[model samples]
Target: MQHYRDDFPILGREVYHRPLVYLDNAATTQKPRCVVEAMTAQYYETNANVHRGVHFLSQRATDLHEGAREAVRRFINARSTAEIVFTRGTTESLNLVASSFGEGFLKAGDEVILSTMEHHSNIVPWQLLRERKGIVLKVIPMDDRGVLDLDAYRALFTDRTRLVSCCHVSNVLGTINPVAEMARIAHDAGAYFLVDGAQSVPHFPVDVQALNCDFLVFSGHKIYGPTGIGVLYGKEALLDKMPPYQGGGEMIARVTFERTTYERLPFKFEAGTPDYVGTHGLAAALDYVSAIGMERIAAHEDDLTRHCMERLSCEIEGIRLFGEAPAKTSVVAFNVGHLHPMDLGTLLDRLGIAIRTGHHCAQPLMARCGVEGMARASFALYNTREEVDTFVDALRRVVRMF
Candidate 1:
């Protein structure tokens, strides 16, 4: 792998007179200089409204905007650009699925299967579906190591199961889910599977066709792109069947006093003047990741995760690590004994060691683990082993203080 740190310019800066160690990647990643330059170049030279203007600048803007959609299509290996719809973020993407597809297919007594380790974004959408349509919500249990119980998940699917929505990776636990198997089980049971790829897409290469999921959603910010930009990939036929989530100019084919018709597959879901700058930035982010190679990024992050895990296990005492899955992502969720995660994070911040400390949008997982919250050190390709060592040292000092 190339020197991953070289791509992210912020890695060179010092904080608190110490080299900064940023491990809060699960929340959001720092943008590479390439991504920053792309956005800057767009605003400085080519800035125009997309898809509606007739001038040269408008054509340029439209091409860049649509090119981003194609980039997203290639990023996840979706069937076509028509299957990709832009949204605000993963939260909005999942909500779009729930509001459009969920409302169309789900009915009273229909069951929606979700796992216990899902983030609130995945959980709350199904809850909304249940409340509005009287649909049944079934939760698949997880093992002690934070891995989902495959047997339990399989048993949860039945003829009444309308859809199965689950996370590709648990944000809090770092457990990479068996989404391919889960998709197969859902399909065999005559149900559609939706993979929440907010965590997985950034950490690993994703081929949606290989996974055979009916839908996949991810946020741009988590992938080193701009915030407020996300992609939702749906099967063409499924998107055709689902009703529009919103109504506006871009998504309509013809509007009249008597009747109105919607546009084709993807635009039918995106119903307003979209986030043009954000999409351009997202395209640049994907380009940057592609240049770096996803496999190398994943390998780098895995190395960092293993290093942190080893340091915490062999070097630190009285630290209770959460999420012990054999195959995991870069996140290390844990807490030192008798120390609240917030306090640990505060001290670590003083030392220029950034980490996340909270429920991490996975309250159910925190409850299952019997902890109020955890201190999480999540990695990205831009992070380094030296940063992990610094984080470990800071953690040791925090443990000693209490």
Candidate 2:
């Protein structure tokens, strides 16, 4: 992990005249040099529109862009690249399913199940769909430890349940939901299952086939790749049935005054000019992680999580830590006694320690935990044990001042 640290030049830089100890990984990861160079080289050498041009540069750009899609397919172990639809990010991906799938399948009384710990991106889209299509939304409840009750989830599914969407890992709690088992349950009930893998893919290997999810969504920025680029992977059968998410030039097979037909599986979802350079960078990011191995990265982050939790609990008095699920990842959310998380986070930032504060785009999770917000310190593969120690020590000093 320490060897890999050099690949991120931002980690070597200082903040507020102190060494930066970045722990806001649940938000986004720092890009590796390889990813940056890949994007730069793509722009320098092959700057052209993809998919329609016959020129050499256009062909090269299209190849690289589609190659990045293949890279994503391999990374997630999807059956084919046809199942992969490039989107703006996880939000758009989820919205794609909500809109297209909603329009194609969902009816007025149809029900969709979600979880209490889902990010707002997952929640809001469905809510919007419910407003438009009159679909009903159900929630899977989690215990105080941030663990979703399997029995409750099992009981929530009715015959009318058309879809079940959940985050693979909670952004706030870091609880790794049993998505594979959940997918099995959803299938048994004849409902499509979608996994929001924004947090999971960067930390662990995600196989869409193995999970048996009908759809999977994740963002590039969360995985050491560029922003404004992500993926929506749906089973080809389902994608073939669903309508296009947006109407634009590339997604059309033929345009006419009276009628029009849509293109194939992925391009139907990808409406406009795709982010070719971002795709190249995303491929570089995925390739970088693949070379390192996801298992190794998971192990490294696990150690960092355990170390940070132990240190925080031992060093700080009356500190209430959240998300104590047995199956969890590197995020630790907590608040010191009688201390506002925003204030604590502000002070920590001055000490060159970066951590996320506030509701973390999961206000429902915050409300469920009975707090307005929590300070979250999330670890990444490039993080080190020493940085965790620094963050904990700085947090302690900040607590003492109160």
Candidate 3:
């Protein structure tokens, strides 16, 4: 295993006079020095608008910006750089597909399939589509262990099903979904498959070709990159068929007051002045992860999660852990007796231990688990067994106080 903690400078900092134990990685990760320095260098040394500038600095900035797009393409193993479209984040990426592609293909009688573990980002877009297009929305249920009932999913794929969208990993439950299998089933039924990879991309290796998903979306902030930058990878044929998500400067091939024609695949989706700094930071973050090796990071996070589960199971009294699936990520969602998740989070914060509380943007999962919310301790490459031990100890103390 690598010494992952050395890369993150924030891990060494003190909060409340104690070292910070940041376990809220599923929400957003702390950036390494490399990613921060990369963004700083761009702003301090060579900041310029991309795609339209005639000067040298402008050309350089344009190259760097598009280079980030190619970096994202390689990061996800996309078929081509044209398949990758930059957006603000996963929310915008999914919304783009829903509004542009969904509007084009879906009709009043068509059905869209989703799973019970979807985040609000994944759910809301479809809801909007459902409301506008009169499309029926169906949900695949999950078992008590938080694993998707594949049997239920298999049953839901009728001839009316035109689209199937699900998360690659459950943000609240930590269940790693079988997206490949789902994609195969959707393909068999002639439906488009989309994977919400917000959780999966940061924790595991993702290959769009291997998964055979028609569309995939993920956010940069969760992967140790800057906010306001994300990726949407769609098959070239599909993206070409869909209308442009926005209309502005760069997305246009020709402009006229009477009529206008749109540009090519990726550019059509990326309208307006683009987040050049965010894309540069995303490229730096990708480079940082690549240098460290994603396989190694996955191993470290797996070990950390196993250690946390073992210790928390043995130490905490009156605690209930959710999502006991055989395959899961670094996220551990649990409740500490009668203590509200928010209150427990406050106590943990006093100890300089940061963890996520409440619905975690997955209210449907929370309702299914029969809890108002949960305290989630999600790990990253930088987290350690020692940090897990400290978190377990803090929980025990909090329980005693109650």
> For residues 363-390, could you state the per-residue lDDT of candidate 2 as single tens digits?
9999998999999999999999999989
Higher-TM-score candidate among 1 and 3?
3
Q: Which digits, one per residue and each the tens of the lDDT, describe model 3 over residues 225-323?
A: 999899999999999999888888999999999999999878999999999989999999999888888998888898998898888888899889998
State the RMSD for candidate 2.
Answer: 0.6
Q: 1 or 2: which has the higher TM-score?
A: 2
Error of 1 at 374 (Å): 0.6
Best by TM-score: 2
Instruction: Tell me the lDDT of model 1 at 331.
Output: 91
The alpha-carbon deviation from the true structure for residue 186 of candidate 3, after best TM-score superposition, in angstroms, is 0.5
- Residue pairs whose backbone atoms clash in candidate 2: none
Q: Rate the local accuracy (lDDT) of all candidates.
A: 0.91, 0.94, 0.92
Q: What is the TM-score of each candidate against the true structure?
A: 0.98, 0.99, 0.98
After superposition, the stretches of candidate 2 with alpha carbons farther than 4 Å from their true spots are: none
Better of 2 and 3 by TM-score: 2
Q: Which structure is stronger by lDDT: 1 or 2?
A: 2
